[model samples]
Target chain A: MKTIQAVSYPVHFQDKAYKELSSLITKNGYSTIFILVDENTFEHCYPKFIPNLDSEKRIEVIEIESGEINKNIETCIGVWNAITELGGDRKSLLITLGGGVITDLGGFVASCFKRGIDFVNIPTTLLSMVDASVGGKTGVDLGVLKNQIGLFSNPEMVIVDVDFLTTVTEREIKSGMAEIIKYGVTYDIKLFKEIKKNKGLHINDLIFRSIEIKNEVVLQDPKEKNLRKILNFGHTIGHAIESFYLESEDKKNLTHGEAIAIGMVCESYISNKLLNFPETKLNEIKEVVLSIYDRINLLKEDFAGIMELLKHDKKNVNGQVNFVLLNDYENHKLDCKVTEDLIVDSMEFYNF
Target chain B: MKTIQAVSYPVHFQDKAYKELSSLITKNGYSTIFILVDENTFEHCYPKFIPNLDSEKRIEVIEIESGEINKNIETCIGVWNAITELGGDRKSLLITLGGGVITDLGGFVASCFKRGIDFVNIPTTLLSMVDASVGGKTGVDLGVLKNQIGLFSNPEMVIVDVDFLTTVTEREIKSGMAEIIKYGVTYDIKLFKEIKKNKGLHINDLIFRSIEIKNEVVLQDPKEKNLRKILNFGHTIGHAIESFYLESEDKKNLTHGEAIAIGMVCESYISNKLLNFPETKLNEIKEVVLSIYDRINLLKEDFAGIMELLKHDKKNVNGQVNFVLLNDYENHKLDCKVTEDLIVDSMEFYNF
Candidate 1:
């Protein structure tokens, strides 16, 4: 297990991670240590994480409810009040020990607590490890909108221990694979091939490679001014879909990965039409993505709601909905705009 | 009027300030310019501010109600939702025009909106001009606790136009004088002499000198790690007093400057007792502070609530309540802890 060097911090893998975390704890000499977790992580991950002996500082655990719906300012208020009541101060250290929801919310809590305190990310779920935790993007969804409130605040270190992944279900792993597939399509065809060939077999190798690709993209443009827009490849339409399902009373909420998986297929169809994306490659991407993810039947009526939400996407600048389109594997075009009709056609293609 | 160079941005005065702002707006070519204001600023400051012909970018006004009590996460969610609803994107520039409340709340709002947007602080009130808008510290209160939730985020530029002070109340002007008085006590005795000699007549000189002293300290320590804590000399107890009065229903909330005036008096007494501070100097300091401000009668019953609130002060690092104490004018100590009995005695002295 090698340490992946980030912009300012290090990302340590399995065995070395605990040692690094312990050393950081002793070195920083924080007034107190507060670990942020959800119910799921508290039940499964915290037990395993606590045994790795660290320091003498008093450690307090703050837990929020599990789920994406809880990832909002209301939840943040609860956690902020909890930290204040728990005697957490400017010198305190917050360790996020769950999936993306915990890390995203916890990272934001630490960043804004007393005008920024130190924090570490110990991403337990596959989605968090590969996508959410590594990048300095810590935020919560606004209403039904995804990641509408947040900032780019890096953690002390990211400890990626595969041991936590044992508790994650197969569905969660596949959800994470959507991002891995994104990396393959946008940055590296090798990654796309690896996931397509082995499915989710080499979990460790896939996670490491996906993180490296994300790190490279983030390092070039941490603030997402230009180069970083490509990472929003599936996110534009995916987030709208995610928000739509979550907001709809009748529809079952789709996981972040599930929504993105459908988005990748729809976007690929759009790319095939506009960018001369090879039809053969589009079918290959669609088949492989659908093989791993259940083909969601997006109703015609749902299109209006999702389209309305798309107008509020964070990536939009100057009233234009921007999408990251690809010509082929590993070749992404930034700031590409498609018409509503083309978008509808792509959604229809996904349903078919 | 000279432009005071900050760590990254410039603090432009009256005439030059508007020019700098107009140029910034033109150069950045922001997608939309959102002006955040309170009801007071919307009524008084916005009309004067808008005539200073700026860019053709779409300008949107986001009005929050005036008062420190409204500075909380709830207000932030409303502003964030409004920004989303009003077509505010990443390329949006937020111009906070009002007192400390607007700048502090608006700065935090802009920083967290779309993971940070460009923001300019136009401090309309005396309190904001000298202290809040200049410093990179932006935040909202949590349950009567002042600045309990926030982060250190600098604005693009700060426009200190004293012409807007015509709209400010005498009491509000006196409130801002607290921080100016704090500058004299902590950083420069010359500032103390000027204020005492002129008695608020020389407003322009006072604001500039206060900003200079504050900028110097902030430059040395932007994050309030070491030397910057000196700025908190009167703040530790001052904020507790402010929070105490704000929370008490029967009592009228003391303005920020008024609470700090009481705090300076109380803290000076503590310095005289613990730090072997000169007795005559402490009396002189007390007289100068009391001359411009009305002394509030604090009851013995109020001591417990004030003391309890002191424990939750943002300046505290460890479990101990930290105070920034001064030996004499321009000579201060950081991270100094005093007995709870002594704190109670200081309150008694303020009453006396």
Candidate 2:
């Protein structure tokens, strides 16, 4: 048992948490174990990772489509039926080993079986391990809408093994960085400065730091009532931008974090513009965000379409768009009322 | 505000709760409050029921195709996007005014809005108020499977107005009774005896009794860990039968409780063979179940299809078909397992 105090969950981190998890599983004497992975993770990874576990614990593998398109009622049924067909019961444990899609959908299936059973998570991607793994948000997408269906459920235990990132591509690596950067922008100015200064820093150490930042934010408010909304900082437009790109066949998706990366820049600039911060700091922010994220090109017309999509964004309360603005960065969240005009201006500035 | 203390979530069910709900929405407050009604309930009822609420609430009535076919992800997205275009948000509350489908889909949409807001359930049909209302098993169907994708979360409040049943058809009324009968067969012997005697039972009293049974089961295991599986008594095969007929263009679905009604009869026979259930008591159950549910004609070959569909039922763990067999009519529960052969025989016997 990897203990998470004042918590309903357990997680394994650093270099030692894996051995602790192995012994803990042995101590509990799990009759059998199953692993849920996506097609990408199963093919590229797992073969090398399998030998680390004891052969006596029965291991079965199940795979699904690796992206948001497959995250639906069809996939959930496929998983539930597959697990049950495989002889899964309350005693059977699930080991989710993939990115956000795998962990989110796996946790959801485990939560609903005969009411529910227990499942363990081994987030292979940095975005999942650092952000989605801790919050207990498990669900599927609702058509074009992202995470339009899900619940707050903590995993039984989490194994944040950096070894899984071996298969993650360069694009995926940057997507994960989007969220790591958000933590610095949202909560810790020191962490922000460090990330800014990480010219020669190993990405692995930054991954650990990112996970710690997420863990701290989630523990303070597990359910996301007040302090938690701060996490939505870039999501208002970030999500809208993602959905907009997702609709265009020729356009590329901004990974969960990358979209939020743009959201952070735009929202941060809004903070400066609306709150009248020093113009030099705004220029510093532009340089900082652009340095991390390559130039994103969107036409002025495209920005108008993005604003139209924003009307459908879920963050709106009674039809007005709500933005989680920052106060000099560290204070994290100041809910700002955003109009279409300001949003358009931010989009132009983002690409410029 | 409603004081409902079943087992886990204790709330004082009174006018005060409604008042608090009403006070919270003083403005035209919503773009429009939508009350989902079915064909059966709209013509037979709901006209007179609208007067009880504040006339200023700007309630809009939307009706959809009733029965299991409507509970699809396609329909969910339609309803969701429709609500969004109608200006729904964190402030708008979806009032599911009918049976399980309305509440289930409506709750799903509300829960997904900006990562969930609030939705109250006013269960018009008898089956919903007692069963579907209490347990937060909300989701839609995927292709031919049932509840293929969804989440578990309680409604903001549940309004159990027994008077709503006046609009229910005799067959619809009987369908809800199938579950009420189940509450007795699985947990309470006296409640079982009460149904056996066929005494002067008022609608209000029956609803209360059913709610009490659900409350007991839910309170002890709100998240459905151990004790909650008892509720799936007939649901294992029941859902299979319902899904089979539901998918067939030539067939009509048995109402949810009705499908489980047949499911109960067959699963009970399995309990008799696998769990050493007394034949005399099983006959008593058959007698009561048949009285409450209209007999349906099913082909002998349908058992093969039904059992095959049971493979997809979320209730099963690891492909091994797990049955919630009766330990004796009063305590149906976990630790119950039946061979696939026994499950086949039980389905065949119910048909012949």
Candidate 3:
């Protein structure tokens, strides 16, 4: 088993991850154990997942409807009531098993349940294992706003098992890859070059390296005050575009990574124009992102909606949109203000 | 002006509080300022409060219906949306100006808003000033459960002004006194005797002493793992009684302190029976509680209802109800399990 001690908790990888989970459960001496899972993971992963653990304590299961839309206060109420109905107390242990939605919402619920109880994460998706699971950020969306309500609470531990990725769709795999690409673009040029060179990389190695890159950055700035803003390389505009598509009636729904893939391209164009980023490097980034994610075209009206959404971004300050742009590979500049006209031009550049 | 530095934040007393708040707001440089007020506070306290502080930042107000019943997810949603619509961001400042209901819910909404924003609490009621404002506990109830969902996040500062107590009703004042009496019983026998002797006590001094006792206990145990359980002396049965009345159609709603007064009497009797607590001391405690609070008759059916609610107490473990019993003056025994029949007897003792 490969173990990475994160800023606040340990992330365990490989076949022996469940063994560590069982030991943690026994050593902690929790009164009861409750598992929170979404509908999809409950069906595909629960049986294979729970049998690996060894514990005599009573284990309860709570399942919420699968998807991002279900990650709301209503679902939190249902899960909270389930724990209450099952007699969960302050000393009870909550093990969240599933992807980002499950881990994020479940983590928030656990953090707020009876002024918080002990919780561990067993992230079943690649996106969650590398990005959501490693970072201590836990929250849910409000209306069309993504991750609008939450807290900075770390789980007691995070268990990452690549075996669960076998059930994930290819689109989901590509979506998770976008975040991995982000870590490379922002911090490690060598890793970015390696990813671009090898299309069929080992999933475990990819997950570990991506998480390592994020962990190093997070350890330096846990609160996203300054240095941590670098982690938002594509997130600022990406999240706005994601929210616009999520709420739009006519547009096709974009996965988190798909929107971010487009966001990276637009942001790269802005970097090249304003930050003196090399045109060749920007082309390389666009080629890799376009090869994995389908190109998304933004119409003139869509540009207005996306730009309006950008004003509400959490990263924005005093109603100004801020972006993290790379001047050279692994040399990132944070909190750079970009004008609406320049953003529109970048969108047109992506369209071309 | 008197100041008590808590484990996490400072509680400022009298006129200097607003000055401190102004300094904090200026130093932090928040994007915007939002004040969360209950209907009562908005009508009675907001006019006086705004004149004291000096800041050029934009200040917005969000008002919710006053009282404990309104402290639920529905109110949180309303306040959260109001902040969102008014352009609240990570750098926004939330100033909670009301009683326990406002501070508890507002603190929670702020803690979860954009994964938390800076908040300052200006407690306007006596109960809130002494008990609610001192503790970092922030949350709202789920159905009949009191504080079922919450977090242990501290506000940046707490402002306690005794002038606001003038608007508080006598019944409300007595409700706040119950927690003060609990602090005396659990830690300071000297303060207990002082309260017993003086009918017309200094309100500010009393508030300060009660808060000091609580802060001392909390500093020792921030997360109620062990020593902090002593603070739950009257809360176990008190919360159950409070919840019972909250849900009952026929029973008149009991204020928190009123319920706790009855709870203290019942638990004192149990202490006398099981732990050899001084019978005369128990009688004196009962006399003081009954003199300030009107004695209410509980039927056999009400006892069953209260007992059922006790099973759902957050302090309980593995279906066993735990109590904090007084073995002697200022000596507490925590996590002591009592039989169901003994609990009924304690209720009978209170009835007599």
Candidate 4:
């Protein structure tokens, strides 16, 4: 098992991660333990998860409904009230056991419960292991806006057990791959090439590389003031697209990775046009993303709606929509403002 | 104006505080400014507050109902939704201008909105100026529980203007004095003696002294691991009594200071019994508290409810209700456990 000391806590990898969790719980001497899981993880992951913990602490399970819709203030209130009613206190430990939604919502719940309590994350999904679990960013979507209510609170520990991934669907796996691809595009060209060559689903090396890149950026700028904005290369447009589809009555809910995949394609085109990014690399990015994620078609009508959503992006500062454009692999420009015409042109490139 | 650097920011005292606020706002360059106030502050204090702010920043005023009942999750949701709809973003600044309730809830809203934004506290009431604004503790009550959901995120600055306090009622002024008295009991003997000697209502020196003591304790232990628990000397029982009256059908709502004044008397009695606190000092404490806060009559039925509420105190560890008891002036014993029989005896002492 590999252990990476993150900005706030340690991220333990593989089967031995549970051992570390047990030790951490014992060391911290928590009064009680509460495990937060969604319906899917409660069924698919909790059975195996329970046996790994060897602590004699009184443990309680809080199960919320699965999916993004449940990750709101209502769910947080329910969870908080449950913990309070069940006698969970400042010394209680909340272990968030599931995907990004569970981790994000659970972390936010724990962070706010009695002015913050100690919590750990055992991320089940590939997206969470590489991204959500590493960053101390925990929050829930406000209305159609994603991550609009949250805090930068790290968990006591993060246990990344890939064994939980066996039950995850291929679509979910591919969804997580978008972020890995993003890390490669933004910080590591060799990593991009390495992932392209490796066809098998097993990519522990790739996930670790992504986390390392994120942690390095986060360490330099934890508050996303400057260097950390580079991490949002695809997320600004991706989150907007994600929110647009999420709210649309006719459209299917896009997985975070799927939406971000579309976002990467669109933003990469913008980077190519405005920042002299290689046409060949842009083509390569499109091919790789398209092979994994089905192309999301955006009509001229949809462009206005998506752009409207983009304006609400949390990354925007002082009414100016900022984008991180890449001129070359690992040579990224941060906080570059682009016009609406260029954004529409980028969407045209994605549609093509 | 006396300026004290707190754990994360500065606490600016008196008229010069607003100038500091203007400079801080100008220097930071926030996208927008949203001022959070209760009805009382809006009617009584904001007019005086507006003239002090010499900035051209676009400011919006969000007013909630004046009182503790409005400090809940429902109100937080309303405020958050309003901010989202109003196009408030990461760069926006939430300037909380009111008593404890406004500062507490507003600070909490700013902390969680968009995973945290910059906030400043311009405390109108004396209670907030001395205690609430300096601690970096932002939260709202849950059900009957006080400050059950919150975050330990400090504001960018705290501007304590005594000018706003001129409009406050005498009852409200006394409420703020409870915390000032608490600071003297727990940490500073000389300050306590000085307060007892001074008959005047003008307590600028006392307020400054109370904040300095709190800031010193908070700096030593930011997370309340050990030393900071001393700050909760009166708060444990105080919060329960406050919650009890707030929820009681027949009882009138007690101000935070009123509730805590009663708590200090009971806990001080417990200290005398358990830790050999000086009998003369205990009498002095009782006399001073009773003179300021009207004696709250707790019937036999109320004891069971108050004790039940006491068990749920966030200061508890492994189900043991812990407290900070003083045996001598400035000599505090933290995490001391008392039996139910002794707690009842302490209440009996107050009843006597």
Candidate 5:
């Protein structure tokens, strides 16, 4: 029973609230346990993780292959099979241990296992702990789409320990940082400034602030009915760039965070052009980000291709490109609708 | 832009509402569109699916290998790559086109595309339309672990057209029917009785009733915070039984519904033993289910295994073995917190 108190969750970041988990279990006195993990974490994390679990003889560990390709029906067959094989009764508890992949997948698994199950998320990566862990949103990806498949099932408990980030690579750290930065830009200007220095980004501070900002947004709108959509500041272009990279042979060359960093910058330019974000601030944003991220050059041909890609973005409400455009740093978000012309114009900023 | 209305939603069904899809799109003015399908649906149903589709110049179709095994991070990566290669952007609209597997996977994909995306579900099978499509629960399973990896995100709209079920096999129908039957038994007694007296179940009538009953329960508790647990009556023991079949080569294989039928009977006996369900009603319950589902003999050696398996049931509230017991039909659901002795005693009823 590990309990982690996120910074924004503020009071304390304890995993599973040790006393709470034990007391709850004691009160309930349930029979079984289910552990959900992906291929990478099961092999790597479970060796040490299994011994510490209190599931006793009733434990079953279900593992899926790691990556976004397996996040569909076929993988569900594996889950359906595992649940069947494990003889998971309704009384069983599923504990998810992995990165965003595990937390998202585990929550979905628990939600649909007998129409829903009790699940706890033990995120083991910077991205998952900060971004995926707090939000109740869970799901897998579909082809040419991201998170097209999912639900809003909150976990019984979220165990976000920085210890998990220790195993992550520099690239993974950056991917998680993209969202952390988004939080600062969308809502917390001060935090954004702090992270911009890249000074307090020593894993612990980033984790706390990122988690804190997310918790605040999530608390306001558990379901992204409104304000939460503001969090998509950099994600709009980030996702498309990610898709662009993923589709090409250059897939290996790009990371999730790197793409999002590029997205934030592009969208920032769009924000400046469409939503009247001041040029001074826009340049400041560009300067701050360009200093950290290698600027990506786009071919003229790729401009149309990229614009075409942006059309597939899910944020388009009803068909209009609904962007979480920035206004006065952290003061406002304009859900602006951009056309291809404007979109193409925005890409020029990234070329520099 | 196709819509289906099997459950008497406030809106009109397929063709009539397709205009609305276009209207919705036209009104909002979308940028891009992406469709999600599994291997089976892609090959079999896609040709028929595309003509009626709300076409976009920048649209792309993504396909994942069909089957539950493929639903996971790896598959999500495949989707991410497809979306990337296809150049999907934040303005993208994802349409899920398949059975439960496709919708579940696709929904998750859209949700995490760039943290989250807006998508719609076109559930092709009865099981999915009735179960998966409505709930917005999306995810893939871990190897030997059912639905171990996932996220929760609802579609912008749910389109359930029974026309798709035409391609379903009898076995598939039964699998879907298992859930229909559960809804009847647990939530609506009238529906249960309606399903019971069937010289053979009428396709439309039975399916309609099942969906209606399910809709009622779902509407009451959109999220399974409470009240929805009754739906797990048969699933509690049933899931473990299903897993037993999957794990043991010698055990007779059963479809999801068939296993639930067995679980209902055994638990009916348990309900009688623990909660004073009348012997006559218990007998009626068993008779109805046994007649519907063929019997499987349980060896004494399997008792310990089954008992051990109960702990794996993810529905256990805390650590307690929670049972959804019925006092009489669907009128009353008694949440029974049973001890090890009661669970073991109940297993005896399933011994042939």
Candidate 6:
């Protein structure tokens, strides 16, 4: 029920968020209100979201297909054309009610529509609530390159309604848990210990804490110049792996969290080898991550492809692929470079 | 050539621009430097542009086709892909070298690439040097709607070299004169009087004064909320006519300045009827505009389409077509509404 203040906007929780959203709509007097949703949100959340907003304004729903594959410029063009066709204009407000793909893509659509329009994020999935909610990073992937095209543009507000979580699948919940686990490894030892307890995770408490931790880091470095790189601890390898799986003939798609869970395990091994990361902590991290996420079998032929994908990582400076490694729980080393052979060795370690 | 200090960056003129650019390249340590140009700039300006930049950084030229018709999302996707394929990254520098279309499109491309990269505008054509060089308005048009999608994002600096003017056609120079003329009508009577003198016009003084007037207006109203609306004095009707000619089956493709010349004539009539603008001054404006530009005959059938296009103007607040009109030289009124019949009469007046 608490509202967390971001750099420019506020993140509200529970039923109170709807009240805030209603007031915001009245205050702004937007010409049109557009809610951007994927198939999932349109089915479940849309039914709930409409009744809550107390406004007589013309509300229109713009829907895209549900998946990471659809998060590209083609879909953006569709939404833009749709908004224009639907009589949406400069004073229109876009409300994104779905997962990361919806929020990220929707936020970007608003940012470019008529130079920029007001938008609010009502994140339905846990991945979006804690991860996408705080960061103003709005963009879609260029090909399989994760978030290759996007800019940091803040939303009017972020509303996190827990009721939407009940509609999500168990796998979807675990996908979000990856980012929370990331917060544990890179920022908070207590969060890591809580997950390590092996009991049912306190979803609400975890989501609130993860948002707080992520917001703190973003406040200091919104553009991801230095300190923010720590949030990318597992992402360098995770994104490459995600892209590799998506493009492979097998088409073994991985949820973002699932890929990142693997990335954390592999990066932990590299951290132990290069940094003075204790052997025990490395083993503990791998065990904890593996326990939460099913181990993915990476094809021996896949290593070269994943490495190739790493070259296109957004974090890379000049020609070198940079990684965020941890020396211990909550102790991060930024911009560390490793050889392709070492990365291969880490994957081999994961297979073992 | 004294550099004009804009809101954030300096506007360097002539030979001194190259010196400032070389020093900037040395200072930023950009990973790569990419220059965006249309075919015209690539052929005429690129040869001269490359020799001036004194850096060993990897320089690449990405060329789009010439003209306003190509200023759409398709061209942007191509440039975005080209930048990605050419190994452009976050630290890359994009130097847009051409007229308004090239700078506007290139600036938008850089602003969205990896969230944003540093870009410099090197306006080669007279139109760009005075108009596009100062305003950070970057975007591509959607369909026939002019500037339907874009954001206000600044470039690192703008290099205005008058030497490139020699490469431009008389018509192209005249297209730029429209914006300078708009500035004259909305902001400074001296500029209007100077253009009225008809002594073949002074290029350097006009360019400098145009930039100063535009920069001063932009500093106060960067987002075009109030005072900045004056800049759109003729754009509301000018853009509709421009789009009308482009989409017409005959494809008359009136040069931007020519279409705007008609717009100023029509809108000035509206100003005279509604705002009590002196009819004699309006006739003087018409004469001055007609002297430099040839009139495009608009079919009676075309008037309805141009009117329909007015509804899509970006300046519309709540379905009301907003126009910026002048009561007198340097005395402007914002958000003026005119009836359809009066608009028709105004066009008839132009025909007369």
Q: Score each candidate by Cα lDDT.
A: 0.88, 0.73, 0.89, 0.88, 0.70, 0.89
| DockQ of every candidate structure | 0.85, 0.32, 0.87, 0.84, 0.15, 0.79
**Alpha-carbon deviation at A59 in model 4, angstroms:** 1.1
Where is the poorest 10-residue window by lDDT in model 2 chain B?
A: B6-15
TM-score of only chain B in every candidate structure: 0.98, 0.90, 0.98, 0.97, 0.87, 0.98
Instruction: Please give each candidate's TM-score.
Output: 0.97, 0.84, 0.99, 0.98, 0.63, 0.98
**Candidate 1 per-residue C-alpha lDDT over A177-255 given as tens digits, one digit per residue, 9 for 90 to 100:** 8898898899999888877788646788888998999999999998887778788888888989988998889988888
Q: Interface RMSD in Å per candidate, to 1 decimal?
A: 0.9, 3.8, 0.7, 1.1, 6.7, 1.0
Better of 2 and 6 by TM-score: 6
DockQ-based class of model 2 = acceptable
Per-residue CA lDDT of model 6 for B159-224, tens digit only, reads 988889999888888888888888888899888888888647778999999999999999999988
lDDT of 4 by residue, B62-169 (tens): 889988888998999999988877779888999999998999999999999988899999888889888897878999988878889998889999987787889899
* Candidate 5 residue-wise lDDT, B1-352, digit = tens: 2233323232224665455566666665555788898777887677766776665646778888876557665777678777766656655788888987788888867776655667877777777766776655677655544555555456677665667787777777767777776787677667667667874766666655665666667677765667877777888888777777767887657777777777887788788887787888777777777666666776677767767667766555444567888787675554677777766666676554
TM-score of chain B of 6: 0.98
Q: Write the per-residue lDDT of candidate 2 for residues A116-206, one digit (tens) a residue.
A: 5678788888788777778888888767766666667777778777777878987787788777777876777676678778755777677
Candidate 4 per-residue lDDT, tens place, A1-352, comes to 5688889798888777877888888898998999999888999899989998899999999999999988899899999999998999898999999999999999999999999999999988889988898779999987777888999999998888888889799999888888899888888888788778776745777777778888888889998888788789888889988888888999998999998998899899999988989999999999998888888888788889998998988888777899999989888898899999998898888889
Which CAPRI tier for candidate 6? medium
Cα lDDT tens digits, model 6, A56-157, are 999999999999999998899899999999988889999999999999999999999999999999899989988999989999988877788888999999
lDDT of 4 at A153: 93
Q: Chain B in candidate 4 has what TM-score?
A: 0.97
Please give the range of 10 consecutive residues that has the lowest summed lDDT in model 1 chain A: A193-202
Q: If ranked by lDDT, best first, what sequence of candidates would result?
A: 6, 3, 1, 4, 2, 5
Could you give candidate 2's per-residue lDDT for residues B92-205 as a string of tens digits?
777777888888877776766546667777787878877887877787765676665566767766777766777777777777887888888888877778877864677667
Candidate 3, residues A149-261: lDDT per residue as tens digits?
99999988998888889878988988898898898888887778878999877877888898888888888889988778877888888888888888888887899899888
TM-score of 6: 0.98
